[model samples]
Target: MIELKSAGELDAMRLAGKVVATALRAVAAGAAVGTSLRELDEIAAGVLADAGARSSFLHYQPGGAPSPFPAVLCTSVNDAVVHGIPNGYRLRDGDLLSIDFGAEVDGWHGDAATSFVVGTADQRDLDLIAVTERALAAGIDAARPGNRLGDIGHAIGGIGRAAGYGLLADHGGHGIGRAMHEPPSVPNEGVAGKGLRLRPGMVLAIEPMLVAGGGDSYRPAEDGWTLCTFDGSRAAHAEHTVAVTSDGPRVLTTE
Candidate 1:
């Protein structure tokens, strides 16, 4: 069932969002050339521990998964799109890294993701990340009362399509509340004025996953977790937890 959060519950979720934002920032800053993905995971764990928040990604076993996720953060690099398990792989210069993180505070949950280059970035990769971030902002901006869920998706997809990037299929945003994944699967592409109508208490995580290969084809890695583009092209993912309020769309996950 879709659970509409109250004012107090939104506040609690915002607290959790703050924890997630801090952890993401720390992991991004610590992600330098030669830095192992495991080390970046440790950096996020430290931030969560310092804030007395628990990781929502750690040990999370969604249905149909091979095993429980073993890391605090999803570190997808280069071709890997999402759910990339953190390992001992050391990042090289120009490696595109995507970090996805979630945190729970006082029973509330918040999730977000960011993608960036490790050291020296190619101009094409930089443009890819920039457009992905813009898509995320557009999605968040569309989360307002009287707007349908499709509007949000349309806003996001329009940007990606205009840039000639491929939007990842089958994986999109979701409702976030007491649990990490809730009801209402938010799509990254749709026709406006369709789907569920936006309510004031609704909170959704709008994420845009874009592939630079200009196609939507992707395959799961041998590990059964990490997803890579079929053409081995790089990808970028961006997200934010937004609250549909009367005034405007309030982005909970921010630094």
Candidate 2:
């Protein structure tokens, strides 16, 4: 069932959201050529620990998963789309890195992700990241009380499709609160004024994943956790947790 958070609960959630934003910022600043993905994960873990928070992804076993997630953060590089487990691989110049992280504070959860270029980035790479960020911003702007969930998706899809980027329909956004995932799944592509109606007290994680090539994706190696593009084309993902309020959509996960 979908739970509407009370004002007090929303405040608690903001705390968690702040921690997520801080963690992502730290990871992004540390991400550079010659930096290891594992080191990035460690940086996030330390931030969460110092804040007295817990990792929402650690040991998180989704349905049909063989085992729980092992890492505190997901470090997807280049062609890797999402859920890229941290490894010993060192980043290289011109590599695009996507970092996804979540935090649980006082039992409330917040999830966010950002994509960045490691070193000297190509124009195509920079453009892809900029478009993805713009798409996410559009989606968040569409999220307000009384707006349909489809409005959010449509906003994101419009930008992505117009850019000739493939929209991955498989994985999308979701309602997030006490749990990492909640009711009312938010797809990246949909018709405005359709699906669940947005209302005050509803919080959601709006994410847009765009691929430079066709939107086709596949599981990486035997890890079962990492997802990558089938054609090896670079991908970008951007996300933010927002809350629908009487005034408008308030972004909770901000520095």
Number of the top candidate by TM-score? 1
Q: What range of 10 consecutive residues in model 1 has the weakest lDDT sum? A: 246-255
Off by over 4 Å in 2: none
Every candidate's lDDT: 0.94, 0.91
State the lDDT of candidate 2 residue by residue for 15-130, as single tens digits. 99999999999999999889899999999999999999999999999997777999999999998889989999999999999999999998999999999999899999899999
Residues 56-98, model 1: lDDT tens digits: 9999999999999999999999999999999999999999999
Candidate 1: C-alpha lDDT: 0.94
Q: List the pairs of residues colliding in candidate 1.
A: none
lDDT at 141, model 1? 90
What TM-score fits each model?
0.99, 0.98
Highest lDDT against the true fold, candidate: 1
State in Å the error of residue 196, model 2. Answer: 0.9
lDDT of 2 at 123: 93
